[model samples]
Target: MAALAAPTWRMGTTSLFPRLFSSTQQTRFALPFFPGVTLTIPIGIQLGLPSIPSILEGIWEGILKAVPKKKTSHMKKRHRQMAGKALKDVTSLCKCPACGETKRMHHLCPHCVSSEQLLHSLQRRKAHPADIFSLAPTPNSILSASGSSSLLVHSTTESTFPLIQTIPNAHKLGCHHVCTAKGGLGNVAASVGFGGEIKIWNKSQNKNEWALDWEIPPSGDVWAVALSENEEYLACTTSDGRIQVWDLNAKQVIQTYETGARGGGSFAMSVDLSRDGKFTASGHESGAVYVFNNDAGRMVYSLSGLAKPVRAVAFSPGCKRLAAAGNAGIIALYDMQHGEHVGNLTTPNARPAWITSLDWSDTGDYILSGSLDGKVKVWDVTRGACVATHSETEGALWSVRWLPKNERALGPGMGKGEMFCAAGASRSLTFYREATGI
Candidate 1:
């Protein structure tokens, strides 16, 4: 490239002007665009920016940037190419001997089989066609709800965990939350749909079928629903932050507790009743957890500490403690009798994920928590430490619950009696048991 003529400073000029770079005075560079093709560029760098004085402005046009050279060597080039090929799984899907989920012919199922807990995957089933939003397990069966307009029931008695019943078209707008009793104790089940519709379901005594029990009228945008231990009373959370207890058998509103002085309040995200039927707890979008006295029909405590939306709250089996977790990703434990923030269980990481669900073991010795990062962690309340963490899937885990400590058959590899099932955006349910106990 040829350089432009120099701008001469006239002998009698009042102000001095810097001379423009001439063709011979310029530094030229050759840039290779392709393998052999090259383009010669004049090195005319501007002396000052636009913010500088006008005297420094008039210079040759500037070539702002140059193309970078290839830095990868022959070894690195072939390593990256082969590494990508190794990462790709086989196109064929075969049933894994360990977890029963279809995977590649020789590769392990990353969703279930892992070295850590091994996560002790027992059985994995495709529970829904869409994302599984909630999981409710009865004594002998597990009920799942998804974005699809149906509910699925799988029996936990056999090793295969077969689908026994499918409630088709159960909800028009899709169900978001489903609950069997407080602790899966009754024949009754309740589900709240995205369209603010609530449906009650009951299992037949003779047949393995689930029939519609009743429907509650939508009041103030009802969302989360929970049934009492006996299934006689149902507690539901409304968007306006009011918790209402309905007499399921009588089909009437029994007790209504207003969270705010006026009427409307924060949106309640989750609700649960104590196993003994003593206290009713609700988690709100404003990070407020309210515990109400069932007998007195009044507020017991407005718990604090969590500064973000609280997603799930669960009462211990003994009714002495309550566990609450949410967007803060830290599990807070409160004394139900005094409502004091006893402790918090946080993951050992820089940024923690939102806790989506929480459930206490039958003995109330351990608390199981599921987070948005698809991790299921069991916490020892006494030590306030995570005993075990299972990362079966990389999708958000919407729900996780202990399988009532039953005689669930061990398919191939054995595991502990205390099994917990996790489900979420993966559109499947993955069950895990304790690895050491088996």
Candidate 2:
């Protein structure tokens, strides 16, 4: 510079440490920082390099970027949260006792737990146009009958509980009661109509469809019906208070049982066949429960606990116990061997809704019941107490059937979660599952 202007400096450099410019061999520049301030910064002017302010600004901007101030991304936050949760789960992993597989310590292993109870309704479908009267659960499907003349088959394993088949006008007037074998593996089904026609159905192996195998010669006395596990016998209740077991192969009534008298007994309202095919049970209008020795062709025991119309009756899978319920709103259990009154299942403040349907679980540990109040209940047989209850609508529930347990049908790595279906005035088939299942 020809004439050195006075080194007028108002403020010091922006650098917090002023000693950074102390080196005598480096060049010091008074950079403009504010209107009246100057920033003194050192620059190495070596090898024909110049101490330029723009280069210092570039370095300062680089430093600013090094002190990151960006917001955390959602993916990172999720990764951190999941990482926290995964740490907790690592502590619970243990070898399962039954299968030696990795399993949560507190949860039951699906391989060994067989008593998983069916709890809440998981799937519901409006199955029929009129009131649904009965439900018969096969291993993978459900058979439903309604006031409409159609017979509907719904698959349990499918999404949305789809209706797989519909037998149009299966009954001339309308069907009231339909039943499948007590054991889930049978291919036979029996349905009773309001017109007193009993139709036998057999599943076609090629198409997995049902066709009318035979129709019992018209008899107006038929009411509720049941099928034996072997699929060889069909048991039905009669309005005339008689229970008859038909030999399907012979197409004739092989055994006929009377309750009160030879011609007249209580109106047989409900009936069931023991899975063992050794006993037939019936509930009647006179509040009586009768058990017959199918092998002996004689009545074994005439039980008397329910003082109202006995509407529903079911036998355990092992045929060790029997359950009977009806207008009295109480479920009475009986010892099948000696026909002793074993116990009763009753709610503390149960409604006056008459129980209309009953079925036993596969392991004979629990029993399911449906009532006129549109409530379903599960009872623990050993505890003699109600374990769970569910209600969907206030319409009368006419039938409830437990879907049989089939390993192939359940698929691999699946629990033996008990399942059952209920149907009634809502004209819908409601499927339920164990609480643990998805």
Tens digits of lDDT, candidate 1, 170-224: 9988999999875655589999888888998888899868999788766668888
Relative to the true structure, candidate 2 has a C-alpha RMSD (angstroms) of 17.1
**Any idea what lDDT model 1 has?**
0.78
Clash count for candidate 2 is 0
* Predictions: Cα RMSD each: 13.4, 17.1
Candidate 2: lDDT of 226?
Answer: 85
Give lDDT tens digits, candidate 2, residues 294-359. Answer: 999999898978889998898888888889999999999999878899888898874667888888
Badly placed stretches (over 4 Å) of model 2 are 1-124, 406-416, 435-438
TM-score of each: 0.74, 0.70
Query: Model 1: which residue pairs collide?
Result: none
